[model samples]
Target: MIDCAFKLQEQAFTLRVDHRLGAARTAILGPSGAGKTTFLMALAGIKRPTAGQIHVGDQVWSDSDKRIYLPTHQRDIAIVFQDSRLFPHLTAFENMHFARGAKVTTLQIRQVIEALELDAFGHLMPRQLSGGQLKRVALARALVAGRRYLFLDEPYQGLNRELKGQIMDFVDLWCRDQVEQVLITTHLMGECSHISDEFMVINGLGPTFLGPLHELVQQESSLKQLMQIGIENSLACQVIANECDFIVAQLSATQLYVAGHAKVGEQVVLKFRAEDVVIAKEACSMTSAQNRLVAKITQIHQIDGRVLIHLDAGQPIYAEITPRALSQLRLERGDDVHCLIKSMVLRVA
Candidate 1:
């Protein structure tokens, strides 16, 4: 059980939360100053709330009525912050052992390292590792610190796509494996949607929206209808052909494309994750997805791990699929596949 409520008064803002989140993955999502991080800090026992009740499992960290408070360390919670503060002098192994204590055997250390994919880097000092690597080590150390309830304060900040994906995937898998409960704060609703079982969206709040992530997404359909996804090149496409979860569209004079949906000449929006918009390998039928197009993979972006592939779809819609999906689709600068998108996946954009 995770219960939290707060009455906040700050120079710039005041937040009051009266909410309950079960033993599931709950995320705090909002803009910069929406008190997401503050809430995480409160839950981690790092910051005290003005008035509220904070509970996890059988313990109560804060209570307005009872005036009960649990100090940070005594609360026994693991925290992964936006900035992973690994000791400069300490190696990953040293850090883990320090956090884990003497009771943790070498086997446990090995398991943590393996689970976080830090086996090779475990011996390296914090300075020698990448940003993603540092966060992984930090999280692993926290996990070893004997805290079952985890509070992550923007764990994905300042990492490359590949590294971010790796950390997030590892975290997701680790959460499932340990049945760990997480209360995370993030600006990236996309990642939150993929990972968290529930979402707590709040800012300088009187009321925070707390509910299932999917349900919230459904409720936002109308709002999203007028809103566009990623600023990457966007365009409206005419669904020329439709199939099971797939649609074929003629994007250009020479380029023909297939994607997730089409309503036979109906104008619809399509998103091609610059990464997944790979060049085709000569129109093939070798994918679970049916939308493949023959067009020029115009450009590439090397952002803070994954490369972005830009393809010329007559009109581009951003399909934010996984990097792995991009690779498996075998998209390149000039190659094409029957863009394998199912029809039902189409949503009004």
Candidate 2:
């Protein structure tokens, strides 16, 4: 278990968080400036807390009362920042070698390099590699430390859908077999939900909720709606059939066609902006929309001239529409509605 109780006081804001996280894998879900990155910095020993303590198991990383503080390099924790902090002058192989903060064997280094598919570009410098390759090299370096704790801040920020899935697969395997504790941060709720077992919702007021993903639906209905403001709605599904320009995916019992070139039986997350969803009382014929699902209205929330409708189409889905449409359609809880989606607008991530 990892315990942290800290207060950060900056010129523009004051943020406080006190919590004990026991989960093996936890995702810090928050907006861009909700102090997620700052919290990670504190836990990684990059920033000293003004008060309180940070403990991982029996090791004490920081204690304000005793003036006990360990610097970043001394801590047995590894971090992969939002930006790939690779040495521009050094080759990719050299970068990985330089991050051998712990007593890692040469065989272990070779295994990590191969696991991340970086064997081919080991001799290339950071400037010569593409953005995705650079990200993989940074990840390889962190894994070389073989630490018990790992912190990843927006690890999938620049990668394409295929690359993101590959990275996520490796991280999932690491959490299962090697890492004792892993904490990742992302502004997009849908991106990391699959890999994380639990999540903490942090906003302007700091952390508001932290618990299992299953309990999130029942315990914090309004908070979930609020978090969806800047994020797209995502549903986890498996591709059942691939038809060149589009593919059929199954989300529970409901199947929808998504425009993406995914192989059959591949797991993917379908993401679309809430505004892109069109609600209808009855299924429309001869419409240009490529996908439609019948779902029940589970929630209705009004914010900033728009009404956010939460639906249950075998799984949770959200749609944001104008207040005028809400009045015109006269939507209500428990009402059956058809959600229209254009396949082109759907992002398979």
Candidate 3:
């Protein structure tokens, strides 16, 4: 568990955070200049807090009253900053090796390089690598360090959508198998939804919401922010079958056909935009949509002239529809409905 109650005075506002985060994987969300980075830096011991204390489990990292402070290196942490801080003189491979000081086995290092697709550019110097390549190197360095806590700040900033998804898969697998805790800060909520077990939203001054994504989306302020950026419905699934064109995933009691490749028995996250979901009063077999599940309306929110419908079809799902459509369906809380989604629209995250 990470128990922290600290205050840091930023130039614009005083950032105050008081929370006990026990989630294995937590995603930090907030607007620009909201001090999300500041909070992460403080947790990493990069920036000292002006007051209060930070305790991870039974270990006290920082306590102003006790006059105890642990340096960055002393903490069991590895961080990937927004910018890659690779050694200028060393090659990418050397940078990663230097971070771990050769403590990790050669096979372990090789596996990380291959998993991140960094083997090809490992010999290149930091000056010779591209922005995306540099980011990959920084992430590789952090993973090789084998620390207890992993902090990633916009780690996939410069990567493309496809590459970002691939890297996220690798990171997710690595975290599940190796790390104890992972905290990441990202503007794109859906991008990390698959890996994050809980979310922390830092607003103007400090953290305003900290909970599961399903609960966070229910808040008026958080829902508005999510709607502005376009909300995504992320479902936890397990691959049951890998067909030639798509993969069959089991979502609780329902089966979802996704347009992606995944080995059978592998756990994956199915992501689709809320706008892509269509709600129906009853299941329709005449439609071309391949995936349909019976759901019950849990909550309805009308924001920015659009209606956001929350549903429970064994798992939480969101659908965005126009106010006119909402009126046409007359969707009310507790009404049973069917969610229709085309297979092609579903992607593995």
All models, RMSD in angstroms: 12.9, 3.5, 2.3
Candidate 3 or 1, higher lDDT: 3
- In order of listing, the candidates' clash counts read 38, 0, 0
Q: What is the TM-score of candidate 3?
A: 0.91
Which candidate number would show the highest TM-score if scored against the true structure?
A: 3
Q: What is the TM-score of each candidate against the true structure?
A: 0.62, 0.82, 0.91
lDDT of each: 0.62, 0.79, 0.86
Q: In model 3, which range of ten residues has the least summed lDDT?
A: 200-209
Q: Higher TM-score: candidate 2 or 3?
A: 3
Give the RMSD in angstroms, all C-alphas superposed, for model 2.
Answer: 3.5
Which 10-residue window in model 2 sums to the lowest lDDT?
A: 222-231
Off by over 4 Å in 2: 100-120, 127-133, 160-162, 190-194, 204-208, 212-229, 261-269, 347-349
- Per residue, candidate 1 scores C-alpha lDDT tens digits across 50-81 of 88788876888888689888888887677877
Root-mean-square deviation of Cα positions for candidate 3 versus the true structure, in angstroms: 2.3
- Lowest summed lDDT window (length 10), candidate 1: 222-231
Output the lDDT of residue 75, model 1: 75
Residue pair clashes in candidate 3: none
Q: Could you tell me the lDDT of residue 228 within candidate 3? A: 63
